[model samples]
Target chain A: MANVRIERLHKEFRGAGGIVHALADLTLDIADGEFISLVGPSGCGKTTALRIIAGLETPTSGRILFDGRDITRLEPRDRNIAMVFQSYALYPHMTVRQNLEYGLRKRGAPRDERARKVAAIAAMLRIEPMLDRRPLQLSGGQRQRVALGRALIRDPEVFLLDEPLSNLDAKLRVHMRAELAALHQKVRTTMVYVTHDQLEAMTLSDRIVVMNHGVMQQVGRPEEIYSRPANRFVAEFIGTPSMNMIEGQVRTEAGRPLFTGPGITVVLPRDAPQALPSSGRATLGIRPEHVSLVAPDAPGAIPARVTVSELAGPERFHFVAVEGGSIIVRTPAATVLHPGETVALGFDPDRLHLFDGTGEDAPALR
Target chain B: MPPRNAARLYPLVLLLLAFVAFPLYWMASTSLKPQTEVFRVPPTFVPETWTLRHYVELFWLTDFGLLFVNSLKVCLVSTGLALVVGSLGAYALARFRVRGKEAYGRLVLLAYMFPGALLVIPLLLLFRQLGLTNSHLGLSLAYLTFAVPFVMWVMRDFFASVPVDLEEAALIDGASRLGALWDVVLPQAVPGLIATGIFAFLFAWNEYLFALILISDESLRTLPPGMMRFVSTTDTNWGLIMAASTLATLPMALAFGLIQRYLVTGLGAGGVKG
Candidate 1:
């Protein structure tokens, strides 16, 4: 129902560890009805940004605009923002029906309106049977539903969810994830979800903001983040089995750019992004699925010995040891490769991600 | 527990029980005994003849009823004040981001550490200067110097144990901070309030030094000081004192009996999700 603009937010805490920067220079704009996810590792400031938007935490310096109005110093109750804490934070003394009606009652809604809203939310969440039960009397899944109901019943301008599905079991989390997506579709409220799970961000968010160590790494659509991460940290943190890194150097050889490393050499394409230093330290990153296994004697293949193989339902991950380091290759489950076997690892030229330097701040070549 | 372990525990439990229950039993039995049998050597474990004569005389012959009413009034007022002010102080100490919060909490307990005898003279002086001497209101306020600090010291931990996330959820759900405390936090701290209320009540009810020094009027005196009248210079009549003591303890016992269920729940049952 509202678009949010967070302008240059910064938050710091004077803790035992000195001045900790929980969030730094965070700025983003979420369109109305958009589902934006702030995804990163622990201590990455994703939750800090969400809390600041929810008015639960005050930013050390920044301005938060909701529908073009500054609400930076407003109390949470005045913000008309509903949040689902990761722990659910249900009122233990109240029954499920009361929990659903608490916000309405606080807003001075009439009795019939509160009853109608509670009944609608309970039915929407399929928790009608738990209307009279306390939070502790319900199971984990039931509590999660009630927490969601409590948030949804408020009908606030924006919804902030802090890893709301993190407490459920694997199956329940998946089910709830789909339900949350469906609910968002139904309500079409501007939602900002915070989580460290990349898969959830990829599957649910309209835009993903990747962050690390209190700084924004990148913000883009899921496919853009996956295929074109802005830096080495974002490249490695967004994928499972992590992207493989080959530390090497790039230089021009006979008018064709070339990458050379221990036990590996590849001739770069003529039109590859050419803003590199002619000859310098660079790292080549490629995802697990981008590498193919072939015979050792195949053309332009790097020879390696399989170190380990792990079965993962439909895919088999092969950990192979090259001369200077290792590479993980995700192959089909029926690949039938064994440890200590000699094979060739082939990189797809189109899928290769080249970074300019070896440090965490290294920018992608293109 | 296993039968053998439970069997071994019963005797020790009974011994402790008897050690505690014996004084209460003696007080009740002495209140029921005829004045003639009260001082018989080798005091009878049970009275030779049970009678309500002491209770009848204590109520009709003396100002015992007035003293009982004054004690109730003072204790109730002081306990109510302590609970209201102490809970707010404790909630702030537990939840707010005040600098030196640890020192502040310790200071509250430090206020309660001074002995009543040491404080009575200064309190009496202060009360007199403010035209508060010989009044039940003055005595109730004097009780707060000890009662409020004690309540805050204990109740702070109870308030702290209620998760802050619940309050945050309430805040985001259209409740103001004070409204959140009333709607979410206070409900979780009911057992703590009851426990602290009982302690504050007992502290004011049983206080004698300040009550004796501050109040000179017989009508304003509480039970603890009023009962001292039974001890004349020549002879100490134990029967009247015992009867008054037994009557004084009845309200406290009834209070505990009524809220004993809340005490068992302790703190929060499921305020948090996981």
Candidate 2:
């Protein structure tokens, strides 16, 4: 096992029209035996970062250190990393046993040792019956298992998985996610996983690195990033149904800061500091699950019209028309609210997030 | 309901059958006819007397055996050389992002498109200056100008159909690029190699122009030019010529019959999207 360190990595492709920046000054440290998931939107350099770590691609300028040794120019085989591609990439002409044995044979391992390792991995992955079958005869799930088995049989210093479950059906993806987590636990190797699915990042990662446009936005545990997002992008990206953001001005009303917009007004917490710039522009961020519908006579309530209601399992999401744009609130499915109905939407002042005019500023809880 | 479609196809099928079967039947019938009834004007479809005189004459009275052996040697050598060089070049073109890769590919196609008839005289001159005329080596070199390009272009297209991921998987498994190609990629390309080999073989075997120009010795002549030797200023022996023609075509017919299944499967695999 080895710890992989990347410092100030940058990659650019010279295309016909102009230079396309794939990765820009990325710095990350992956500890030995830790699973790190790099999550981002498409074209956000997640795969490029993984490829650089695997030594399959070269960074335009940077340093990659493995176990305190510089290895930026090493070949993929010399890097001692096994990568499982998104397509499974199984050798169609070879049987499962041969596929698993190929890496060992190339490494010049002894025959008995190679056979022993193959048998152990096949038993661990429960793929013993598939050992004699070619890739085409296997189903999608079986192919994925064989791909994982092929990587595991090598027993390399690091395991790199690039969206290995993206090709499976939805149900199989869930099942394989758990299986992968179990496999990682059993092996305890340094793993660098890349995926665009946020749930996969949350479920499988010891630490999740959220990136956007070739830049790392935040890195932390799932719950820490969910509760304390570094900026508006993380706040808007990590949650389901996304966070409702409303732009307004921050003004003092009777010595207490109050956010006032066109069709809505809300009182801020009394002890909240007035540290925001006097740009008179800020955005209020609140998750849909944080907003609640209450009786009209209740204290600290804002009146709004219900635009639509969608039943999602036991919870119903109500799209309420408030000042600037719509705010979604999750209520009980038993709630009898309909379109065009007037209701009082209640939310705690402490749960509100206040940000400056620019979306990049750190969010301050009100 | 479909009687009209069947009726429409009958004449087309009949025309195809007649066009294909007529020459074969005539060759076979004439090979058995006596030398006297060969041009009986009425053209007997069946001979009154069958004879093995032509076959006997061809082996003993002529150098047909030597010509057959010469053709086989030249065709086999040329086909083998073409396959080895073409497969190596094609694999490089298929996988490597070398400088001027597209130019190299277009150059291969251009070589194939070049007219062989125009190059014959210059090639003869070059071969004569090098003391290569009337040599098997000269004929093989001339044949490669056409055969290599055909083999390379077809094999390049064949290799392109195989997924790069398969080779990458092998590379990750500790194989070098060439090793991966030999172990994984070439196994999938067996059918293609066979098909390309057959084409190269046929191209060299049936060539008449260069063989006529290069080989002055009757013993060194290939099947096509050797068959033409039966014609002289005084008379054209139709019976002997037909027998020799039938003899010359036997190898090609057997070869095609042997590899037709593999040719179809190989071409179909390369043609289909992976």
Candidate 3:
């Protein structure tokens, strides 16, 4: 219902460590009805950003504009923003019906209207059976639904969720995650979700903002982020079994760039040799799925020995040892590969992710 | 514990219980006996004939009723005042991020360390300047000197245990800070309030030093000091004193009996308020 503009938010907390930067010069604009996610590891400032948006936290210096109105100093109650805490902070003393109706009652809705809205929300959440039960009496999943219902019944301009499904069991988390996607589709409210889980951000968000150390690493659609990460941090942090990196030096061989690491050498593809830094030292990044296992003598493939093999559902992962480093190769479960087996690794030429440096801040070579 | 091991401990428990219960048993028994049986050569464990004569005299022969009303008035007012002021102060201390709040909390508890015997003289001098001597209101305020800090210390632990997330949820749901407290925080703190309230009540009810020093008017005396009238320098009315003592202890016994359930969990829930 409302577009949010965050203009250069900076938050610092004076702690035992002395001035921990919780957030740093964060500026983002969320369009109306877009479901955006702030995804990062723990202490990465994702939750701090969400709280700042909810007005629960005051930034050291920033301005928040909602629908073109400055509301940086407005109280949380006056901002018309609702948040579902990670704990699902439902009122333990109130029944589900009362919890759902709390916001409406605070806004002074009539008795009949409040009752009607509670009934409708309870039905939508499929929690009608729990309407008379307090939060303590409800199961984990039911408490989650009640918490969601409490926020949804408010019909606020912005809905904020802070890792709302983290407390549920794995199976329940998936089920609720799907239900949340469906709910967002139906309501289409401007929602900003904060989570440390990458899958949740990838599946549920219109755009994913990956963060690290209180700074935005990259912000793009889920596929764009996965396929074209902006830096070394995002490249390694996004994918499961994480992208593999080889610390190597780049040199020009016969007018073409060649990368040589401890035990392997790779010819760089044409088109972006200029993207290589002047120092010629860079990190080569590649995903497990993108690396192919071929016959030991296959042409242009790096020979390696499998150190470990793991069978995970439909895919098998092999931790293969190359000349001086190791790489994980994910292949079809049907392809049986054993430890100590000799094989060769083939890098997908188009899928190669080359970073100009080995540091976390190193830029990706496009 | 196993039933056999527990059974072995019963005798020691019974002996301790008897040590505590015997005085109360004698007070009730002596109150029911006639004046003739009070000073018998061999003290009777039970009255041969139970009579209400002493009970009647406790009301009609003296100002026991006035003293009872005065004790109730001061205790109730002080407990109420302490709960209101202490719980708010405790909640703020537990939840807010004010600078030097830790020092402030420690300072408030330091007020309780000064015993009434140590403080009674200064309090009386200050009360005299304020023209509060010989008044029930003055005694009520005197009780708060200790009662408020006690409540604040205990209830701070209780309020801290109530999750901060609940209040944040309430604020986002459109409730003001105090509204959120009333609707969410206080309800969760009910057992703490009850436990702290009883302690404050007991402190005010049993205190003798302050009541004795602050109020000299016989008409305004509370039970602790008022009970002295029965003990004359030449001879004391043992029968009347026992009857008054039994009656004085009844209200507290009834209060504890009704709220023992909350007192157990509430007192234990704070873990270590020390």
| Model 2 deviation from native, Cα RMSD in Å | 3.4
lDDT by candidate, in order shown? 0.90, 0.86, 0.92
lDDT of 3: 0.92
Off by over 4 Å in 2: A250-262, A267-280, A297-300, A332-337, A348-351, A354-366, B1-14, B17-21, B44-53, B125-134, B214-220, B269-272
TM-score per candidate, in order? 0.97, 0.89, 0.97
Residue A139 of candidate 3: its Cα lDDT? 93
A1-366, model 2: which lDDT tens digit per residue? 889898999999876789999889899999999999999889889999988887777899999998989989987777778889898889887899998998998899999999999999999989999899999999999999999998888887889999999999999999999999999999999999999998899899999898888888888888877777777778887878887787788888788898877666878887765685477788878888889888988876778899999999898999989767798998778986889999888776767777776465445443
Q: List the residue pairs that clash in candidate 3.
A: none
Cα lDDT of model 3 by residue, B1-274, tens digit: 8999999999999999999999999999999999989998799989998999989998898999999999999999999999999999999999999999999999988987867888899999999999999999999999999999999999999999888899999999999999999999999889899999999999999999999999999989999899987999999888899999999999999999999999998998776532
If both were scored by TM-score, which would come out higher, candidate 1 or candidate 2? 1
**In Å, what is the interface RMSD of model 2?**
1.4
lDDT of 2 at B137: 78
Pick the winner on DockQ between candidates 2 and 3.
3
**By lDDT, who's the top model here?**
3
Q: Each candidate's fnat, in order?
A: 0.95, 0.58, 0.95
Candidate 1 lDDT tens digits, B1-274: 8899999999999999999989999999999998889989989999989999889999899899999999999999999999999999999998999999999898898899978888889888888999999998999999999999988887787888888899999999888889999999999888888878887999899898889999999878889989999999999878888999999998888988998877555433322222
